[model samples]
Target: MIDLFKFFGKEESKSKDIAKERLKLVLIHDRANISPKFLDMIKDDIIKVISNYMEIEEAGLDIRLSRIPQEDDTYSTALVANIPIRRVKNMGPNRG
Candidate 1:
């Protein structure tokens, strides 16, 4: 039997990777002059707006700010969100 954990890297390694990613995000936020509380507020607002239309897996949601390369070789900050939607809400005839 194959060791699935080995095939997909060990849990310890995965945790380390997660830590590295979190650290990177923290640094990016600092450079962008954005606070964690502000980011959390934005995330909460996003969830509220999105939840009005569809069911979402809040636990699996991921949102971050990243730098995107531009045509002029300049980098612009962007808000990236990965929201896992479960299903769309059924809107009745009276619903807009």
Candidate 2:
């Protein structure tokens, strides 16, 4: 089975991928200067607001702050949210 899987192609090592993800999260939090509790609060609020407009895949929602480098070597923090929408709400006059 391992040989068969390798026959198709080999992917990045899981451990390395995990390490990279952990480093990214540490950097994001450090640059954003936010605590885990605060992050959770923000995530919850986002879910609430978005769910009001559309059905969302809450379990798959990914919210993070990323540092983007600028031309002058300065960095800007960006709010990155990946929310999968299932369907839009039909609120008629009050639709979002």
Candidate 3:
């Protein structure tokens, strides 16, 4: 059988892509005058809130700020979150 992982791409190459994304995120944050620590705090808050309703793979979580190009040739910073949810939590009755 063919190696599917290799056919698509390897983990090592994925890491490089991740690194590039991170660099882009940093640049975006800087341009938007946002601090890295502030981003971390926001990420933590998101995880805490979402955890109440879902079982997520925190290790695979990727949160960053990105620039969305506007029609006027400008850009707006946006909060981008790529959270890997393993499953939804079974909250009883009123979703406690």
**Candidate 1 regions off by >4 Å?**
1-20
lDDT scores in order: 0.92, 0.84, 0.92
lDDT, candidate 2, equals 0.84
> Model 1: how far is 96 from its true place, Å?
2.2
* Model 3 lowest lDDT segment of ten: 5-14
Q: Please give me the total number of clashing residue pairs in predicted model 2.
A: 0
lDDT per residue, candidate 3, 1-96, as tens digits? 999889667877989899998898878989989899999999999999999899999999999888999999999999999999999988889766
lDDT, candidate 1, 17-51, per-residue tens: 99998898887898899998999999999999999
TM-score of 2: 0.76
lDDT of 2 by residue, 10-45 (tens): 454666688898898888888789877898899999
Better of 1 and 2 by TM-score: 2
> Which pairs clash inside model 1?
none
TM-score of 1: 0.74
58, model 3: CA deviation in Å? Answer: 0.6
**Model 3 misplaced stretches (Cα beyond 4 Å):** 1-23
Residue 89 in candidate 2 has what lDDT?
88
